[model samples]
Target: MAIAPQWEAALQAVQSPPAQRRPGRPRATGHPTDRYEAKRKAILDAAARLFTLRGYEATSVRDISREAGISQATLYHYTGSKPEILAAIHNLMADELLPRMNGILQSDLSPERKLAEYMRAEMELIERHPTYTAAMRHKRWLLPGAAQEMREKRDEADRILDAILQEGIDKGVFHPFNVKFARLAIMGMSNYIGTWFSPVGPSTIPEIADGFARILLQGLLSASPHR
Candidate 1:
């Protein structure tokens, strides 16, 4: 996740703003909280687009400010630095997906069905939030202290998947294998959708999800002793 040197320099510059401001600043007319949130969302939306379309390192704070229709100073008021903007984007994805995923994990469906549903749910999330998912997948290294928290969230998801795999093995529904490796394999396949999937592509999200579930749950090899 090492950000490009240029982006690293931009981050450093944004982090260290001038200590003084000119006198006679104009006062706000609207409620501070509402105005603040609106501006924050605008910055995040703009940053997500830039970070996804252009690499995080290549996208400057000025670029984000222009895209957001706010001055660089105003952007700083909402987000302290470029890294904070990136972190907020990651947080947005986590806030949207984690609770739903927890619910999926707690569902009473059999492990096999649960896994398929989980895969479908993830695919749907990616389809709905392509920018956010792309940022999560690609710019994770830009998050400094927050990277550990993100990893913890990922580990939590992994544990849920591991539980499903173990339950399947316990019930003799899924053939035994290394559960950890299996979880990684399944996750690797699903997480990669953001890189190449398109809404207008040949197949829909559900079609891809179904295909992925079938491949993961049912082997490609014929009925054999290994299976």
Candidate 2:
């Protein structure tokens, strides 16, 4: 996924090379920055898994340290505090996801296409990173510092969805359904995938996304409602 302008620091940290190695040394396996970023990503992935399985409140720095195969002090060097790690997990996802959703809101696609594409994009993200998705969804209100702005971004997403639904109504592609309720229905249906989606499952993410979209766009009744 293209990096969103919202958070450039992590991407920069990974991309920027650090020229730090003694001339006579054995090259230290790779670039120092690459090593740093790889280790950091591992730490975050470990934390995401633990946060998803053990729950954030029950997990600790020591657990993350052990999971990452590093000392507590070393974990601190990569990620300052537990809260910061949590914030980073959420921030990274937001950086990759929110921009795409925002773009969909402004895309030239028809309303039906927009909603379907939006659902697929979102489900694909969740399917790709189910651990982080579940971890972030759990205790979403626990964000600290500037990360609290995530709540605002989430609210903005809500407005974007509402506008898309409104566009469908205005364009005569959909009946004038209650936007709030429709939004809730779709959001609930999409989010539940985090709990049950499996790579080996009978359905792929695109299939699940398309199926859910079809259910919303077309009623369950294949013919007239049977009384």
- State candidate 2's TM-score: 0.77
lDDT of 2 by residue, 9-111 (tens): 3233323222233455354788899998888988888887777667888889998887777778978999889888888787777778788888999999877
lDDT of 1 by residue, 90-178 (tens): 77777777787778778888776788878877888877766666566555556668887777877888887898888777777777788
Candidate with top lDDT is 2
Model 2 weakest 10-residue run by lDDT: 1-10
lDDT of 2: 0.73
The list of candidate 1 runs beyond 4 A from truth reads 1-38, 137-143, 220-227
TM-score of 1: 0.76
Pairs in clash, predicted candidate 1: none
What's the residue-level lDDT of 67 in candidate 1?
78
Best by TM-score: 2
Off by over 4 Å in 2: 1-35, 140-147, 219-227
